[model samples]
Target: MKHTPYYLNKPDNILPKGLTNSVFRSSDPLAYHQSLKNYTVTPLLKLNELAKYFGVKKIFVKDESYRFGLNAFKGLGASFAISKILEKDPDIETFCSATDGNHGRAVAWSAKLFGKKSRIFVPKDTTRARILAIENEGAVVEKVDADYDETCEFAKEMSRKNGWQLVQDTASAHYAEIPAYIMAGYFTHFMELEDSIHTLPKPKIDIVFLQAGVGSWPAAAAWYYLNRYGVNRPKIVLVEPIEAAGILASFKKGKRTKPEGNFKTIMAGLNCGIPSLTAWDILKDSTDAAMAIEDSFTKQAIRELYYPTGDDKRIISGESGAGGLAGFIALMTDPRFRNLKEALNITAESRVLFYSTEGDTDPENFKNIIRKKK
Candidate 1:
């Protein structure tokens, strides 16, 4: 996450009407199925101990774990994006997506709620547990041999051939609309985070570390803060797996960059080599910086979640859900991050807001890793 001098053309000013309101409170992910739906996103308890350990201001993880059966913030993007796409021309047959894992699950659950059939295509090596989770939701899963990008192309081709509505998130003119809808669903995330921060004792959120897949959720959340609060907005940091740092690299290079290598990261949700165009557009204007973390660092973050000294069982979160905290820890551990750390003054007073996006979305897999600690 280098922030060298670079220039970007002025960004777009297209704010969706879905974000203008602040009454987010949907208990059912299906009920609030839009870009930004029902949820008073609340500020979870900040670990004063962890804050001091990190030598940064207060660190409060904004909990998105309370969404419909699905826990991660992807609920916001996937549900809303898919709904918007369908609303224009509701497809009764099938909704399709390519994913490392989470996004596909989200779309499957969403399609089920809307009384639609769904199909998910995942890389051949995708864990049976993750794919099974989607199947448990009643959506059919197709396994493809190859990488994430390849699966995505297969999903598109299959959708075209089968007349299914392809709910692809990586942006394009037609697909860009879905990202916009996805971002709209995330407005509640910002609304709830702000509400939670305001409720804190010393409630100034200095920084917000967010993980990016298609980049819509975090980008839209930060954009809402910038538009409504201006200088009051928290410093936004975008995180991704190092192997799939395509968007971050593109932003850093002042031109869009897409990687050809197979994305091999444990943080599946953050493993996209190409990002949503709409999501990218907003991040270009709103983000303060970006960072990437190795899969090893994400594993270390899993340790932090489980090792809550003195028997407080930390909530078992999916690996993808831990991406932001992983990147933050990665940044702190890096020698290059030393100077950036000093410059950012990321101390306990910082009131940093992060997200634990999902819970044990894949239980057996999560248990396998957790059991190893014993």
Candidate 2:
């Protein structure tokens, strides 16, 4: 089947009533993170030049490249989930998980920090840099000749056989609480973003563009914003690579559904074929719209961030990290996506927010893309 870009607005009839504030009272996993050495909040950069280019009032990006020194936001979730798991079973000897890249590294890092052994599984096609990064964190790397979804299954089996604590980010009927903790851990980013936003002169965020893989990050963010702002919550747009736009497919079907095909995309971090069950529960009713974009758009967005035109600050965002910017730029510049722009009410006064979820996680690929253009 030929993949085409598409957008779908959430049906009003199915929109969720606001969730209770109590849900977030003890939900943040940041307290454990703060206890770690050298912990710091990532920067919320205001890209005035990009705002001018897009004809928006403001554009703020939560740069998560340096999160926990892991170079991606995945550390927050992995660390939080693993920490919580260890609290219950202090004698747990091993931890395990499957990843496209960043999440595996986070799991390994957390394992190392807690003085536990870890075994991480990755797809055959995973980049060498990512595998090496995971190994450097003291985890045994197991390469499976399968796609990410298959690797997840392999990891699950391995975890059961070895009695290792599984820290997978996606949830199913059999394994829900751990993934919920993973999602809860992700709240740290939003909590930090909220504090940063309050420091701004104009604190109102009009629209939020979040990129989705299995949908955990966006779900966590959407939940935080929905509860924090309630009726005044900003419009949320979920962006994903066209090849693996599982959440987009689900939204289009008006229920959860998996995307078809190889699920390969340059945005490897977002190359998930299935949406996390817990994440889907939150996004199904909370998101305002969903979008699928081509790999070329993400490439262009990387270059845009690396060498911005006008006075925009240079941002070293990786392919997956730039997907939100790619979707936002597509809506603003591409005639084909003009309707999506209007549907999201992207007016001149709109102040948009995006999360740059990673940096140059794959350094060689980052250099090739940014340097080739130069």
Candidate 3:
């Protein structure tokens, strides 16, 4: 049952025009993130041994496991979105959202931080550890008997009925505002890199591999890099699970598309079928290529990160968090992706970047995966 990877390169090299909006350039993200308790810049690790193994000059990984001790990067978006809403309406008491895992925990954490109540809904397959994590954040957690998309709808309906503010990252017709704020909040990490990258041996990044669930995180990264570097921006690659490659399917259709599948993957956070409209708008023009990887590849990536080569640092990456790296590894090792490697111009001299978006959020599953021998 080995599923081969897929890649689609855009014909045009146009920069993302939509990213030029003032919200991306605003100073609010940095200010808001700094105001939070225990706000510190996450580590940017240089994996030289891994670079050498892959015949690359440098491989820089932004480890977000240390983010607020949440072991994931979703807090950046959830915290900022809630703060923005509170600034406008301080009287709001309850916030609600649906998630596969990380985002819901982040939303619950943010609500607790703001002294507000939260109601979170998750798909039926969500792990017990994830549910407990959200509950620990002081949120009422419910497991909806549906997929991620259907759970989102169920949460929306309940939010409407109970008068709770929906803080979802996926944007619909009239729901673009909060999603926009959430995406803008991701600017804080890239902004930190803008300053710290100057100190690296290879400051100019040749490419970036960003993992997408509903595409919001990767879209934010794509928008930030394309806007910051203008014409000389690094090549952006969007990666997702083969079973839930919504962004890749949308890229092929020249419009927002919902991929047709069961959307089941060990990468729980990335088990999404539909792309957010806001994410699609920017990604459709900004990203260089879209790639999909099998869940097995992500398992391999997780093991690789956990067991480092030579003097490289160990990164505790979850299934979804290892997705971007999984795509890169597949392209390099699998002869099936030779054309994709060449199309992206990855070479011995290329300096690549990746974000380890989460740690081992599910401890038992992580242990079992790492213990398995292929």
Candidate 4:
């Protein structure tokens, strides 16, 4: 894919000076963590037992489960993105998006933060609690067809016709600038991740398994950490749900990957069928690997984090957010991946990091299954 310049990289950068100072601090072309102070970069907890089981030196999870009241790292992205966009184009009277849950809520809430009217379109299968949660954030909520792609189509079509500023959570060439800004917002989380890494005991980013939703966050993260740390940078592993492995499949396809598909995944954030051109361009030229996991594995991984045996301080982790660790665990348990671990040199000495991207937007639904496990 030929490189079309990012908004941040453009010669006449249209971002206002105030917005640039407030959000666009990072050197990474598509990210900034200037607003990361309010949100906690949840710790990279050492999973000694899991490490031993996988025959690795160390394993850690960058629990994004502690971000603001929302309990997801996504807020960092949407909030920062919306702010800069608003600062640059304050004339935007309305903002809108299509999300499985997280991105829409974050973008809508951030829009409200800037006193803009916002709306979120979701798939029909989305939970009642999710709809209400986004609505409570001062967004008008609408439900479309069952699939995520359908919701995205609805949101885009509506935004175009109604003259609302469309904040498509996924990326596309037609309107790639916003997604680039979104990726820059996501960088703040990774920037926080870089800081948190230094505080960890014997922190060495030999491997990083990151979740993907059109791959914006991880691509921006890869750009930052790899450049900051140099060629010995961590080998990045892109994690997506099995049904939504299009990003990975697309990566291996080089420039030949199709831009359209009918993909499904239990990980709502990973439910995207179309590739974000912004993310695809970045990830294609930079990432180390792309992988996918089953929904059953996602369930177990969530339990491992939130229901740590005998520990009652329940960690608030969203279902889809835990999918990165799930994919990591799958790699650990895989016969084919055993030797690839050697490629990463992930021995007892190697350190790993994975981002927990969202909190349980629907606690009752999360608890419905979780309560039984208890």
Candidate 5:
């Protein structure tokens, strides 16, 4: 199945009016996150050379590679969700979740920190490096033969049977509270980025290209920017792997939906088949556009980041981390996506922002890809 890059524009009034009154605005999560040990704001870097290449006014990449020493942004949500769960059940004995890699490790790390047992479930094809990372944190790792969504269901059942709290980020109507905590936890990243942008002299980020999996992260980002900037909020572009474009498919159908078939992609972290219901509610009306791109484009993006042009700083963005940049570059360079570029009002005056959500999470595969390039 050859997948082509695709984009869709959202309706003008898709979002609700006055997002400032949203439930997430009641308390500031940043203060709690900042008080944690070793919590430092991740770097928001200016990619001058890339900006010039794309003919954009400015481009900023929030590098989540060093976030909480987890080499991914998952920790921000995992740690906070676990803390909130523990606050309610101080005597909770076990925690559990499912993931392709990063999120499960985060759950394990948080569980270890809180002095509780953890059980992490991953798809059978999950990389050894990620499994080792999870196990290293004292969590029992289980590899299931099914895909990510199936693994998530299996993990949910396991948690229920054992009376363990499930910390999965994707939410259903019946299971929304924990995922809401996880999404709220992601506010730490946006809060820091907002502060960093505010400090800039121009502070003119016009658009954001957000990579989506189960849609929690992007929804969190959309919530923050919409509330903070209101009508002036940056345009949000949701990017995903074509093989697992659940959010994009949902957007096309005008409702929440799941992608069919086995969701396989090199960008493991973004290979989620189902969209979180909680995230869908926030993103459905808030996002400006949604896009799905081929896997090869993401590989090209990884190489570009690894061996940057001109004086651009070299970044070690993993397969999943590079998707947003890949989507952005596609819109700028591919003639077929010219309509998308124009619709989003991407011009030389447009300042753009995106995230490198992880570093070399799978070190062996990273080494192989980088070495193959030579």
Candidate 6:
């Protein structure tokens, strides 16, 4: 629904010196991920037909649905943070966090993996299926009479009072280390892609479209590419639902800011009104652009991935998962985005990459959307 260019005048090929030594840039995270017995690389799919349809050189989609068998990418952050916490405090018995859906389930799954108890707080609007998913992960689910941000505060308070570790993705002055570890854990995805880069049509990707919620995941991506490629890094675009486009609002204001929205979008995983401190710090300087899209566009993208062109593999993307591709489709097809398209240098030779962050996390909604006519 909206597009805004950011950091256009910033010089290219220069390393963000502040982030060069950050956890996201270190090899430790990737090494840690590889040490896990369950760790396996997710597929980086080539969509030649889709590239032809969009008139782009190529399109690569990282299918995160296969990650940890949790059907979402949040497990990467949660597992890493929990593992690091256990290393520091092995006596810790319980962990707690808040979520719209995916993060809480991830925390639960990670806690279970570590043989610790988990208490997950979720917004009142979270779907029943997601709640059951968290419960199935062996977490005690608490539905708060509040939105995502308020629920986060509630969970933090509960964790403090109960002597439980708060495994939240967002960072505050009092809590930065765990969030950093979580972000570092997300580096594994990029590392996996790097290993397979030799097999791609091009060794380097021209652009990357990353979907954001509280911004942690995309921040990890931006930090990785910025530190690794320096001035030659791919153009990174942040995508979010227009109703909860906190990252985009922050981009326009040139500082951290919250957005006011009805919070009824089908992209439940991206319905956060606040941006994380660590994420904002990295994204504000590193990313190329921010896009806010409507639910209709995400639905269209889900259908497009499920029903692919030619022999392209089918990807089961949820509302939030399809956001990156949704943003790409909007830029290419909508006349309103022509200027931004040109501004980002999107052309027939541009090799674009997208992350499908989830796979039908909300099964019923995904089914209904897929059943509807395009």
Give the top-scoring candidate (lDDT).
Answer: 3
**Tens-digit lDDT string for candidate 6 (43-96):** 989999999998999999999999988999889989988887898789999999
Candidate with the larger TM-score of 1 and 5: 5
What tens-digit string does per-residue lDDT give for candidate 3 at 251-296? 7777788876568789998898689988888888788888787788
| Candidate 1 to truth, TM | 0.84
Error of model 4, residue 152, in angstroms: 2.1
| TM-score winner, 2 or 3 | 3
On a 0 to 1 TM-score scale, where does candidate 3 land against the true structure? 0.95
The collision pairs in model 6 are 13-231, 14-231
Among the numbered candidates, top TM-score falls to: 3
Pick the winner on TM-score between candidates 1 and 3.
3
TM-score quality measure for candidate 4: 0.83
The local distance difference test score of each candidate is 0.68, 0.83, 0.86, 0.67, 0.83, 0.85
Per-residue lDDT for 219 in model 3? 84
Worst 10 residues of 2 by lDDT: 13-22
Report the number of clashing residue pairs per model. 17, 0, 0, 7, 1, 2
**What is the lDDT for 39 in model 6?**
82
lDDT tens per residue, model 5, 116-152: 9999999988989989989998999999999888999
List model 4 lDDT by residue over 158-269, tens digit each.
9999999988756665776676677677665555654556333333667788787667777667655544654556677777776666676675555525433345455777
What is the lDDT for 32 in model 4? 37
Error of 2 at 111 (Å): 0.8
Error of 2 at 96 (Å): 0.3
lDDT of 5 at 24: 65
What ranges in model 1 sit over 4 Å off? 1-43, 198-203, 260-262, 310-313, 372-374
